[model samples]
Target: MTDTYDVVVNGASVAGCAAAVLYARRGAKVALLERRSDINAHKVLCTHYIQPCGYPVLAELGLIGELEEAGAVRNSAQYWTRWGWIRPEDRVGPGVLPHGYNVRREVLDPMLRRLAASTKGVDLLLGHTVNELLTDDGRVVGVAGTAGGERFEVRATLVVGADGKDSAIAKLAGTPSETSPNNRFSYFAHFRGLPRPEGHSAKAYYLEPDNAYVMPNDDDITVISVLPSMERLGEFKADLEGAYRRFVKALPDAPDIDAAERVTKITGTVNYPLVVRESTGPGYALVGDAALTSDPLAAVGCAWAMQSAHWLADTTAPAVLGHGDLGAALNNYRKRRAENLKAHAHLIADYATARPFNHIERFTFSAAARDSRMAEHFHVFGSRLMSVPDFLSPWAVARCSMVNGRALLRPRAQPVHSGERVLTGQGAR
Candidate 1:
């Protein structure tokens, strides 16, 4: 069998579906292929925290309303460090910084697939696996593979690889990729009745070489994740359940895990290497994890996927519609990917080393915990809304320094400890 489209996207998860829906909505015929026959299957190892940068794209796709209607929790973040808590001034209403959503991928993935399948010009082909790129004179023009135990081919003006970090399309297309090792491993699961530190707020603990998150999700469910350095693997391997519970239960301002019921089996990602692939070539492009899979600790995967899809569609759909230059459109898409993500990837990769916080991080974190304005800035930057240069301006640094100076002159106060050292497993402080 054979099919033709203006764009053919491989992998119908977040990125592929977003691209297909957006492209078809823009008047281009698209074919979205997924290897998994089960449309409802979700990524088991994801935390599914969508950042603010993804809100506009989600809204544009008309997914935000549906997500909210499905009980997605709108949230901001609060961080706990040794200095104290960094709480940004709570802002009410829309258009605020550090705002995002927490909807489980079980709901989100199927929703995206259905949206793409129902879009006017998309053919959602589940159970289709691409085995090789169909090339025309040195440029990828389509794909050949198997579907339902039969050979098939899909031809298109553009080919997209959204198959994730282990993208078969990317490999078949020979896309150059670079990888950085992660020094930590992650484990997380959903629980019911876990107490929240505040209403609909996500919490993070920066415990030097280890970190943990309490992300509130829809339907009164909460996700608790711990990312401890690789050296602690033996502890987790010996007894993952007990160590996981004890670790989270010991954090400062920790949630009441004892009061909660474990609703899901634990999921862990122990070898998630930071991967960056060349975003575009000839007649092909990449989005989501196929393009870049940074440290999951930043929770940028889902957001970056949708936003990159938006970038790809916004830049290249005109060309697909015969209204612009294809080569130039491809160039613009490449530029967008780099300009938006390169710096963020650098920071995420650096932190993936699981090293202790650097001097500047300590200085800024201390000041942010002391001052609301600094906290807001820190949150904004951490949310990836502000560039590193802008966040570390001389004015910002001077103000943070002032905040720290004022704190040093104040009388010493009793230290805040949860009951024990969670990371080092030391006795009560």
Candidate 2:
């Protein structure tokens, strides 16, 4: 027997589940397919900080409270460059939305899938993997695949490729994608009893050609991630624990190793590149890493997944509900995703090269550290609330340039702090 739905979403992970839920809530019948037969299947390797942009969707899904109840950490970011710790603002106070959530994907993913499964108009298809696109006259009409080792077909008006970076839907449908080479190796593991960095829920250390993160997560466990230059891969592969610990422990003011206990095996990825896929194709749309994959330094992956799903669903839901043109809706989805993520993705790609910060980057970082307004703008930009271009305006650049230029002219005034902790979140100390 064949089943049909308004939308058949591939990969019932974060992005796919979000798309399925949104579509179902809009009264469109949706089928969510997941290849994982285990009900508790979840992602193991992720930075796990959902950016501020994801809050609205979590609220819409009514899962924010559930997340909090599950011990999700409220997060803010403090950055450490050669200049100093570019601190967050004085207040981590509540805003239109809570700051953000820091929870492991192991906890977050299943919760998201449950929401999709329980939604009224959504059918959850577990243990299903798409093998071929069922097309008609050049338009994708549905998909045929195996579910629980049995062959089956499902027809849908629109297909969504929310599969991870390597999307089967994109491959089968011939979705055009551009790939940017990433020159870093990343590994992360959980630890308990580590002292918190401060009021900020997460902190990043930026060493030229390498970076590391300390993320406070649920159950009092902290996740420490390190990304080193590709040339250093052998060192990591040789003694991963030694390399990972050496990379993170050497950072200034890091956690007390004497007190913390390594709670999990070191896990990581080496070859995930920056991929920008054509977001919309004939009779279909893509979201999450499938549509656009960014550098993980900014920790935007998780939230981008949820946000892209929201964008696709909001833009295409009208058409799926018979109130708008499908082509126009798909176009809107493509445009919106590009409009929001293009500038951000460009900056990430640049940073992904694992090179030292140039002069302009130093100026920007120092100015943001020295000034509250720039710091606020940086916060919004890093939170994915503002675009990179918007965050670095020409006027703001001129002001920063002047300040940095003056400092350069005077020997006593160094615009960038070399080793001092210039920012402490409250103010420069």
Candidate 3:
């Protein structure tokens, strides 16, 4: 059987949904395909934190009100470094936009999928898996798929590959993806009744060499994640619950996660490498994880996906509606994404190797932990309010250096067992 649309998107996750919805809203008929039987499904192994940069897109899509109504919490970020806790600076002035949202993918993903399905020009096909790209000459024209043991084809003027980190469409389209050595594994779960830190914000506690993040979502539920290097995965996986508890307990301002009721089983992913791929080619484009995926420590995935969708829609709408060339539009999309995120990617890629922070990072974080003004700047940086270079201005670096230098000078006390190490023995943390 054959069907037709103006654009066919071969994934129904947030990125794909965003593309479909935006295209549909622009008056193009869109077909959104997903392999999952449940259109409301979400990626279970995600942190689900939306950065501030994604707010404009959500507001533009008219989803802000709905998301908040659905119990999404507005929050800032706190960094728990070994030096001390770096909370947002209150003196930076009031009336600033809140940093980001700590949401559960279980809730946000379904909401987004439903919104896309409800758009006027969208045809959402769930439980259908794309088997190959249907090309005319050398240009991608549509997709072939299977649903209910039957073959089907969807022909369109353009095809979008938003099938995520392991995108088959991207591979079929001849787009090469490069994998980096992320050798990091993460264990996460939801808990209730754990005392949230005194402030209403998400916290990233840097246990250097390892890290833990406590993100407060809607209701009393919080998402706590531990990211340990691959070499340490065995120690963590051997006794997941115990290791998790120990990690939480070691936090500077430790939370009572152990005392709290376990609301979900400990879930983990092993050796998840970060992947980035070229996002555009003739008659085709990619969005979200299909284009790029980095470590989740930054919590920018959802926001980047939503924002990229909006960008892709704007760039492609003109061409799809007869105002520009589809190939040129896709090329433009690639340029835009690269210009916006390349530096960010470079920084993350470097950090993932667990390299010791340069003098600048150490200074900035330490200063932020000492001064609210600096902390606010750090928060803005964390929330994507500023770019990396801009956030690391000469003045900012100097201030951080001065403050950190003083702290370094005042530090005293030598450890009696400086080289002592804790060995993992098939037990929890």
Candidate 2: residue pairs that collide: none
- Candidate 2 C-alpha error for residue 143, in Å: 0.9
Model 1 Cα displacement at 176 (Å)? Answer: 0.6
What overall lDDT goes with each candidate model? 0.90, 0.85, 0.82
Alpha-carbon RMSD, candidate 1: 4.4
Residue 26 of model 2 has an lDDT of 88
Question: Which 10 consecutive positions of candidate 2 have the poorest summed lDDT?
Answer: 89-98
Instruction: Give the CA lDDT, 0 to 100, for residue 422 in model 3.
Output: 39
**Which candidate leads the pack in lDDT?**
1
TM-scores, each model vs. reference: 0.94, 0.92, 0.92
Please report the TM-score between candidate 1 and the true structure. Answer: 0.94
Worst 10 residues of 1 by lDDT: 420-429
lDDT of 3: 0.82
lDDT of 3 by residue, 76-99 (tens): 777888678887845644336455
Q: How many residue pairs clash in all the candidates, one count each?
A: 0, 0, 4
| Pairs that collide, model 3 | 242-428, 242-429, 243-428, 243-429
Model 3: residues with Cα > 4 Å off, grouped in runs? 92-97, 405-429
The weakest ten consecutive residues by lDDT in model 3 span 420-429
In the range 130-183, model 1's lDDT, one tens digit per residue, is 998999898999999998899999999999999999998899999999999999
